[model samples]
Target: MNTTTIDKPATTANAPGGPVPVCHVIKGRVVTGTDVEYGPARARFATPALDLDGMVWPRREPGPAFDVPLAEIMDVLVQTGERLTRDPDGLLAEALEFSVLTSPLPRSVLERSYASLGRLFNRRSMEFQVQQELGGADVLDGWREVDGAPSGRRHRTRAFPPRLIHVIAGNAPGVAALSVVRGALTKGVHLLKLPSNDLFTATAILRVLAAVAPGHPVTRSFSAAYWRGGDEKVEGLLFRPQFFDKLVAWGGESTIRGARQYIGPGFELVAFDPKTSISLIGREAFESDAVLADVAERAAADATIMNQQACASSRVQFVEAGVQDVDRYCALLQARLGVERETASACGNPLASDLRDEIDGLRDMQPHYRVWGGYEGRGLVIRSEEPVDFHPDGRVVNVVPVASLDEAVHHANVATQTVGVFPASRKVALRNALAAAGAQRVVALGQAAMFETGISHDGFYPLQRFVRWVNDEG
Candidate 1:
């Protein structure tokens, strides 16, 4: 670890009784100004404005990071991570304190999230990701000989670092950290457009890198700022291929659709499209009272990760059970949803009014549909003969009864990102069918939100897409 003394800089400058000042980081330097802009108002607090033009890096050439060895970059990141964990009142802490105002997640949940942010920067974990995704670190450092080619000619290739504008999602604070780590490991020049929901995390991490290794290539390669998603003045000029090679977007339908128009010949979009996850519970869960309790807890774990705000959190569960068994499972699942966990809180943003109304309507539908729990974020479970019409959220899980596990596959489509299956053994039987049905990942019933390092996200390895492949022909 670097063990450098960290300075506690004010993240925001509040002008007496005015809105907080949100500053922009250009490369490794922080730039603050009097120019004011406010983000869309949320339930809790409003976002402070930033200088958008200051964030634009006019240089067209690659930065020093493009030439540095991958190992050196990893070392800087590891030290930065250590510093993040060790510092009691550092940038990560500052971000957590500010997050309470901008984010809907409770204080305890945010504390838990900030505490684990350092783990994403592990050295061996990063090495594994590089090896798994891009074959090895050698390709990133320089060109390597092609193993097999159809033509009788020698060729070499390198995974060139791209100039990227990451439109990162703010649902999980971890996304910001992961983007920085990925951007650094790939040696890319990253300009992260911070989401309104999470405005501080990425900038704080970048600031830590600046403190740990001042003027380091990795630090100079990163810049983070905030601007509304569809701001044409900024997007119209910056989205061009001359400025950035790709826009890595992570958000819902509106965010993706907004970024699509900017894609063209030189610039492209690597989209982590909005996706929903489901669960398939085998009848074996009901084999015994102890088994049912354990299964319910597992199902709840998947359903309530990040309070069902994460893309991997299970929303709809298909169970191979009769009415009595399924109803019992729903009751148990509802109770478990309110239990606190590392990534979830006992309560979250209350269920949306429309969703609450939908549940209320289902209540009158009687035997055809049964609703458990309510809108206060204690979690809600609805048991129905078929899938519900509205999307489940706010720790809500819809339990759909099916005669066989195979019947659940029909409900999954291209939008499905993960499917957690019970009885672990059944995953093998359903993995192929689930993938064929357009689902990207399958895991044990309780492991939907537990992702391993180097795993593919949204059906592709993101790090592979973050770089450009340049070849040398001989």
Candidate 2:
């Protein structure tokens, strides 16, 4: 495999900061962030259990980046399920804590943070509502509609049924709210785990819940904290004979691999696996080069959405009727995207550099490549005769121009996540083909990133993934 990573300027991780305690809860199990020391204001989460011994968590920035010790967490998850009878709400309450803590980031701070992101894939609206509830699912209890008998039949049915642990992703600022909403509505208590990339948000959400439901069982039933995803030490405990009924996570390869090893005997895993995305263009793209330009730009924007970190961001394009037509379309597409700078939070030192190198390497592959912008600030563009083979460290794209949508989509790998299209009709022809070929989701040309909260992910409605079903036959 071609490994191209941009090298960042070296900086000390554990400068002078002493032990900084941040509370941690994994698989709905609580652990104070006591022993963890801060280190590396600049690093990536490649492993599990962060070693903050020499790290510094800066005040202005989201501090201390490190791996959650997968080995350690596996141990916990392995045993967590069987012990649920003892403290069923333990993990659920912790996640609630994280969701509440993260919801109210001072407008000034996150707006600035969002601005610093510089050309991200998705943008946040000024305001979003957070609905917190209980009994439906200790975690998802507050959804729009999720009760066994519905309406007035509440007295006969059991409320707040158990079974599920969620590991939340911080790719979007308000994701914790959504995840918690799902679990709560599904009636599952969450052992919500946060990504270090956006820990402040989770912490913010949790802080909110603690005040409102301080004494409730479900209130104490949840927990929110961070644990490197792959850590088996704690996570593994979930696999042994019903430690937890379910494990839900939003992750890529490394995190998935870690999940695989620890699924205990009676436990089930509802995974939203790591998938890639792409866009399809029909000869209909030729209808109006102007419209094509808009579509292309939007498609590219979809590719870079979430800095390309989101599984749904489009990565490749299938241009119909190749040649000068496709080339001209691509050129105009480039022109439109040339100066489009996004308002996204910049991932941090080494990450930016690493992503840049991946983009550069792809550019190098094609001698006909025409890079439009500089590597530093905003509006960065890299153009190739066809889309090149760029690695997605985030904020970079690998585009290819195919003669036909069929030729283009055939490249769909097991990782394909989203596919953008120009015409609405073509989706009918090729959608089944995509599913058979392993593609997961498809959206309109410009609407890829705006996936609604109501739709199902992959093949199933995720609320089902977050909550367990209990049947009592009369």
Candidate 3:
């Protein structure tokens, strides 16, 4: 581990002459910093240099050294998961808490997100995802024969873990952790490009991995560093096929666009594009007085995942009901959105100044649209005629009333990611249309926020796609 100290000036962002030194774990070793950069939340923090030597751009070779057995890797991950579960108050968790606190999200929102992330860090979930993605761990070994081959010859394939660069999103802490899990499981050497909004969770996870299995092969194959997203000197060197083969990016339009310039030929990009989720509630939701509130609560649950910041979190809800029933459902949804929950809650994302102004403007134009709830960081719903023109930010939702679920299908397109359908059975009726419209996932009503291991993210098994599929033929 390498550590460097820098003298702090009298006038600093936080405390007087206090240095907030952050470590970027590079290939099992910690690299400290002497350079300071103005980071998120107006805080001055150490910026560690990118160690691109044998770590990021390694000499690509065929062997188990770069690719460990799946069982052994899983064992190490199980130990890491156990530590996170058993010792929540341990040093690693504390570091994560501190890092999360510095984010612009409200304390309540961060608390809820972190708590939800804790549940996802267990062994069962990790193992399930591994099975879902790769079918079994043996595929990593090389050329496992797929069923149904030619008479004499054989068709065999393997998911080869290539050198990868994971640009992680910070909206939900789960993304960062999941990236590490995928990278570790694939046995890929990773250069995790930590997002500016979050620079802590990955480092903390790395530390836990080191603690759980000191000098383990899987633990040593990872590295993390931060630089301005478009830093030419850094990206130019690392983006080449010689250095890295794949870039797994998770972010909004800007992040995806930035990675595009460096993508071509041998350099592949597995992009989990920025997307908006929606809820389609059939008229059945409002069919009876008995189930009205239940449907609304589920719809609220779908919209409020990660306080509506997650890509899979529903932003638009198409209620296939009469005007009165739609109004009633909207009212119920507004109430449910304000209730506190471990996964999502009322103290949601704080609306921006311009958004507040826009909401205020829409307030005057009634009937066309009605704004429910407050601009005080609670949650807001706009009952609009069609889909709202602007992409809603914060905890704002746009409830569009439709004549039927078919009409709702027209609104969904490639940009739409997840669709939570009411009454569960409705998904069957609408699945083909939703899939044709480019929606990746459609879940049971109110379960848009819910996740399962091995679920195809963006219509593909991510782990299966992350590796280099090599073939052997006679």
lDDT, candidate 3, 53-151, per-residue tens: 644544655422355677788778777777765555474556555675456555676655555454555667767877788877778755687666666
In order, the Cα lDDT scores of the candidates are 0.85, 0.50, 0.77
**Per-residue lDDT tens digits of candidate 2, residues 394-415?**
3444445566788776877667
The alpha-carbon lDDT assigned to residue 106 of candidate 2 equals 29
Task: Indicate the residue-level lDDT of 405 in model 1.
Answer: 95
Query: Ten-residue segment with the worst summed lDDT in candidate 2?
Result: 121-130
Best by TM-score: 1
Q: RMSD of each candidate?
A: 5.2, 12.8, 3.4
TM-score of each: 0.94, 0.66, 0.91
Pairs that collide, model 3:
none
Which parts of model 1 are misplaced by more than 4 Å?
1-18, 40-54, 58-60
Ranked by lDDT from best down, the candidates are 1, 3, 2
- Model 1 earns a TM-score of 0.94
